[model samples]
Target: MDARRNDVNPQKYYVKKLCKIIYFMGLGDCWYERTEQSRMQKILYAIWATLINSFIILNTINELLAFLRTDLSVKEKNDSIQFRFAHPCLCGKYIFLVLQKHRIRALFERLLEASRSVYTVFEVEKRSVWQAKLCCLVLAASSYCTLLFTVVDAIVGYFTQGIKIRTEVVLYPTPAHSGLLINLLRLLIEVHWWCIVTNMILVDCLSSVAMVYVAHKLMIVKLYFQNLRQKVISNIGKKSDLEIQKEYEMDFITGVKLHKDALWCAKNIQYALGNVYSIQVFESITLLGMCMVKMAKIDINLTFILANGLYLVCVVIITGVYFSSAGNITYEAYEVHNAMFHSGWELAHLSPASRAVVLVAIQRSQVPVFLTAFGVVVLSHNNFISVVRASYSFFAVTY
Candidate 1:
């Protein structure tokens, strides 16, 4: 597909579930081509995104005030705190994303192009593509399962107990209380919670997908290194020795830049999404601890318990997705260094400049490209374990 054309080939990426949710939620206008979306459509989408964000913000504030002002049950308060604190991070995520959408889009386009290059070069493919697909499925499954339990539980609770507001974030003014009016009020409240839930899911899924995308690119870069010999030699079918050395130099330089770009992409991703992940880590611990305390405090219904259990599992899966993706970035960075030697760079007689380029590539790749939050809290499997420990500590104290 030609970027210069007005066609919607790029929309292929947006056809997936992840982009569709972001689209309807109005966070996906950027995904559309210029010709595909009208000015008014973009304006309305922007307005919709803002409204959804505003609703979630107000919902959070309302619930915080409710928790402070009213004497609620232990279970309600726990659930309220858990939902409230966890999703306000979405506002921060939204701000960062929108402000830097164009830059990130360029980076994403590069990743997409690199994916194509990998496919073009290696038709049979290797484990990287499948690995990324598996992660994508895990990410999507996490969101789907959350929505499943959430909607089901919401329906069950509504039928069993009419006009209940979990977080007390009532958006509509249904002050004239009556049977029909009461039902309408309850329904509106449910819709409000759904908006908030959707907001939260959008944030989580987008960030997780971004990590997976970057990791896939890094894996593709690893493929470049893994096949660096074939990659360079393929261009050297009938070339002379000097020409071949120059080709080697050129390919080595490309690999180095590719390595650097992957690292740069990882860091920029950390800039855009790492803070939220950091906040999420603490939020999950707090929420998890509170969930445990709620369990010990009272005998909850099975539906409620099941919802909480799914929430716990998702928290782990989401965090693991982030941490594992980051871990893979570092692992591939180092692997590129090791792969340099195995690339058969020694087969050809080289000049000083070529040798220096190879040396620089090895050195740069040696300093593993790790992602972190605010210079602390490295996103890796090790810290994933730490998150569980911290949550357990919180539960111990709160209990």
Candidate 2:
């Protein structure tokens, strides 16, 4: 009886302690495992929540519009409204179901564990940084794809609902008369198309930049885990003062490596930022090309509005999201590095050869991401700014 009671006490004590740790860690009891998310994770959850809400709202609005256009019976109308309201709930349930896979659970649990290491006072291997970044890449890709689909849907909706138009008259071409006004009007059309097409390209470029930035972050995460694994194995052959300490370190190291690897593999491949960047680049360019072809058939006056107003708004939104996502990714990487550096692991303490390894790893892990993000922002912002200025110029000249 006493033995059983003792066993129960330890288990209960651990549970209570874990609960307290979780509470302080800022990760609520929502995750089944006791692991907590870093700042990035919390931000990701919030962003994802906002995205889901937006999608639901947009879908609901679309459905309502459809319902208003329909001449349905009272019962059918009520049923359709109810169905639309429940759609988001159903989608949530389905997402949960997918997350229930054992492999996925393992990956999530590993990531949660990694998140904790970022705060550890001891030398932490740098692998978790890569893992977190990879996760972000996956997440950002999913969001980008959804946003792309939304854009496509919006364009389709415009076609179905009919495009808004502004009036402009074209004078008949005359061989006998050289009218400067006619030439000027034609010039305006060319300028309008140029602004619209360029703006669309800029928005597409922003999307690509976001995707690439996320991918670069993932690479860092992978490096952190790899370094951690090498450290653990290297320490295995060394003699330590306490047998228990050796065993503990080895166990922790093995567990971390395994957890990271599991999570690394289980994540949604489709969500990877690597493919998202290239694919989006191709798709966006293609879509923009199509828009240009379509625009060619329409009047220059109408195109001017879309180019100046509609495309301008899209470029702004795309640039905003791109920069925001890049900032998040960079911040998370810094946090991971800060945590691991604090973990008592010093690059200087390692042997010369080991120090080289560590330095190489850090350089590879961080530099590419920063470069990609830098390039994206520079181009996206400049293009958007140029389009805005040119549009204003066109308006000023024409009016």
TM-score of each: 0.81, 0.30
lDDT of 2 by residue, 1-399 (tens): 000112122222322343343233222332335465699987876675555435434543444454653344342343344334333333332233234334333433443344433422111223323333443444345434433443454354347554212111112222123468856644453333233223233223323333332343343444444455455446554745344344434433443443344234323322322233322222333333333433344334442434423433443444444434444444554544443333223422444564454455444334322313212422233343543454445434433
Each model's lDDT comes to 0.64, 0.37
TM-score of 2: 0.30
TM-score of 1: 0.81
Candidate 2, residue 172: lDDT: 23
Show where candidate 2 strays beyond 4 Å: 1-113, 117-279, 293-296, 300-312, 319-399
lDDT of 1 by residue, 1-399 (tens): 001222222323532455566668756533433436688987887898778767667755655555553545555556666656665654565555566666556555555454353232232123344555566567557756765776676567768876353334332333234588777656655666666556555666666656665665566566666676775566565777777787677666666677766777777777666676776677667877877777788666877777767877877787787788778777767777777766657755688877877887777778867777556878887888998888889999877
